[model samples]
Target: MFSLLRSATAFLIATASLAQGYSNPGACSGACWAHDPSIIQRTSDNLYFKFNTGSGIEIATASSLSGPWTLTGYALPSGSKIDLAGNTDLWAPDVHKVGDLYYMYYAVSTSGSQTSAIGLATSSTMDVGSWTDLGATGVASSPSKVYNAIDPNLIAVGSSYYLNFGSFWHDIYQVQMSSDAKTPSGTSVNIEYDATGTHPCEGSYMFYYSGYYYLLWSHGICCGYDTTKPATGDEYKIMMCRSTSATGGFVDQSGVACTSSGGTTLLASHGTTYGPGVFTDSSKGLVLYYHYADTDVGLGDGSYLFGWNVLGWSNGWPTV
Candidate 1:
């Protein structure tokens, strides 16, 4: 009986360990229409701010990660000034703070074209009316260009800053940025790609943890809003790779290079939520903010809600 009790206790502990993962804290309220959300917490007031893709760039604020968020305003009311792409709706904003000012890198493009540009804006405060558009970051695309320049993310390593951006055509690319964080100071390098068919990787976000640079990205089709979903059920899952160096040579758990279409699945569509954005909160630590089509709310009815889960790490990999 003593041996049996010990075995049962061990089994229970193992089951609990395996069950550790992401959990949605609660429902958010007020102006929660968010997609590809990038969040930052203000150091002065401790208020949480979210920047998302929308008409210009949607800004929302809340006292906590889970809360009654209120729509503050748009980053650009007049729209971008990038030739044909300007004045159109912006997509996939990445926000970072340098010194005292906040720098927001946003994408400008037509609905389905490689002719796109990544623009920058800065503000002392993240308030909607305070932003000053700094124009294009010298990352632009023509019809002849192989990589689409959208979904921009900024990472600062030591004193150098690098910008990672790209979509469908060649997956994700990285380039060193000038000190101002606006213009590219070096040639762009292809960091992540998919050899499996149409190359469905985008939204590249790099997080530095425990001496490893974890490159997290969304794979497969996304942004169906309501009417559409990935044809393959497994297409729109969050995938990840890691490396000691931030610039290149990211690999999966099995030692396959990310440039060769290797990635470890982090999160997949379970229940309703899909297409998670890698985020970090002060209290919640690492979080995955995603959009979900509520089944009870029905599909194609335009009810995509924001969902989030605080991530747990095991063996240097994030699980959610």
Candidate 2:
């Protein structure tokens, strides 16, 4: 019994030490604060642009990924055209360039409520004054709806484009987009869910890597850090599943189906960082960019900061 106890203790210590080795985010300055950040680099000038959840989807730009970022202005200076009662702020901006124009999809909703709508906007330069709000994308939810439509993510596979968004209720869902990319073209398909605990999952981002389509999302409680905060290691963390097809058949590294409550954790709280959520790839290698609360700054929405680190791959999975 003594020998077995010593072995278990040694294994636990080794595991904890390994978890603490996650690299800190690369240095950043100027407008470092961001929440639910979506980063993309323009092919035209190679300039980096990051959009975050805020009033009218806050816009910031930097010459480099790890940067002296400057907050330019909001994408929709007048707020979303699709008005919901008591919704003053836009949440979760996902930006992508199709053809010569850039399209940004955002969410309009109040906190913790199922009443939400996903809005779309476009720009030629991605600058503050260039964006034109195109209103709702026809993907929305009410208290009566089965899914909460927030955290909009757009991905193009071959000739088809799909929008993935959801929260709380049914976790994550994907819908095919019309050619013009203005609204949903088909029925929404439920892709991923977490049956564990409160079923907290959102911020879905789909990206094609190698030959597989990877779906990554933030799982667990994201906000309300001061009050209804989740237990330690249960706050927001990045999780992932992959599939050969873009629409479905996603599975975790352990071969567990994502729809059946299976997800492989990609990043979680470690060292001074907590609640690493959201992800976007930059031109500089396979860089994983996100927003996290610094433990030193206190865990809360107000202390959220932009974070990033380049990633490496082992076998077929991504490693931090």
Candidate 3:
């Protein structure tokens, strides 16, 4: 166990050193947002594109893993078509860059409901204003629920594209996408099941880390409201689990098996940080995007603003 831990640690540190030289991740005030961020490493220009769902899913380009990031504003523009739940469709977007084209997978619906489905959009720029939506996702097996089949994320492993998505109702499902890059093919697998159904899990960001496919997600409540102190189980937190395959049977490095009932906690609210996004900064390696609520020292109300932490792997798992 110790040897495994050491090996993972060294790999992370070495990668950071080689991918180092950046000022680091984190920024001052006003860099905040209702963050459900996803990052894409544009190897072409050596730039890391950071994007998120809330605060209207804007694009920001950073040369270094750290600051000096330039904001490109809302990618979808103000007049983009929204389904029904107001403009809440732009939530938890997964972004990828093919060649020079940046593609974003996002959820679209009038209100947050099972009627919600995934939409695909492509842009020559990270600007959503220039993105072209591929239209509605037909993978929703059940047509009753309006907002359930949203939150689309795609991973290109080898030559295959695997798409994963789900909502707060149940487990997330994975379906293979055709190489055409727009449609789903093959069998759909319901890999990660949230058995508890306790409203603590959703948004599974699966990434390959440390020779394992790590599923990082935010658990508990998200986007704080000025409430009367949330109960212990109700506060938002970041958790993770790993599997040899993108599908399932993931366990934390501690051998603590992660199920819907109990999973490994990565980053919990340190008085304010909540609902995080994890990605590898091509310029700086692993990075954690989160929101911080300085309730005790906030900008008035006890809500969260966008915050980030540079990630370092310790003991074969990610550490903040």
Q: Please, what is the whole-model Cα lDDT of each candidate in the order they appear?
A: 0.72, 0.76, 0.57
In order of appearance, the predictions have TM-scores of: 0.89, 0.91, 0.78
lDDT of 2 by residue, 1-320 (tens): 00000000000000122355577777898988878787777768878787878787788999997789999988887888898953458888778887789988888988889989999989998988999988888999998988999888888877778888898798999999998778999999999988887788888877777888778888877776756666776777788898988899999999999999999877777777776622333444676778877767766677788887777787787766
What TM-score, to 2 decimals, does candidate 2 have? 0.91
Q: What is the lDDT of residue 7 in candidate 1?
A: 6
Worst 10 residues of 2 by lDDT: 1-10
Please identify model 3 stretches exceeding 4 Å from their true place.
1-25, 54-56, 65-70, 78-89, 110-112, 141-147, 253-262, 271-275, 296-303
The lDDT-based order of candidates, best leading, equals: 2, 1, 3
Between 1 and 2, whose TM-score is larger?
2
The digit string of per-residue lDDT tens for model 1 on 1-320 reads: 00000000000000012233435324788866666677777778878787777688889999987768998889988887776554458877787788789888888987668889999989888998999988788998777987989888888888888888888898889999998777999999999999887887777888777899888777776655345545644335677899999999899999999999899877665443433455566676666666555545544324555666666888888776
Best by TM-score: 2
Clash statistics: count for each candidate: 0, 0, 20
Can you give the lDDT of residue 244 in candidate 1?
Answer: 94
* Worst 10-residue lDDT window, candidate 1: 1-10
Q: Is candidate 1 or candidate 2 better by lDDT?
A: 2
Question: In candidate 3, what residue range of length 10 has the lowest lDDT sum?
Answer: 2-11
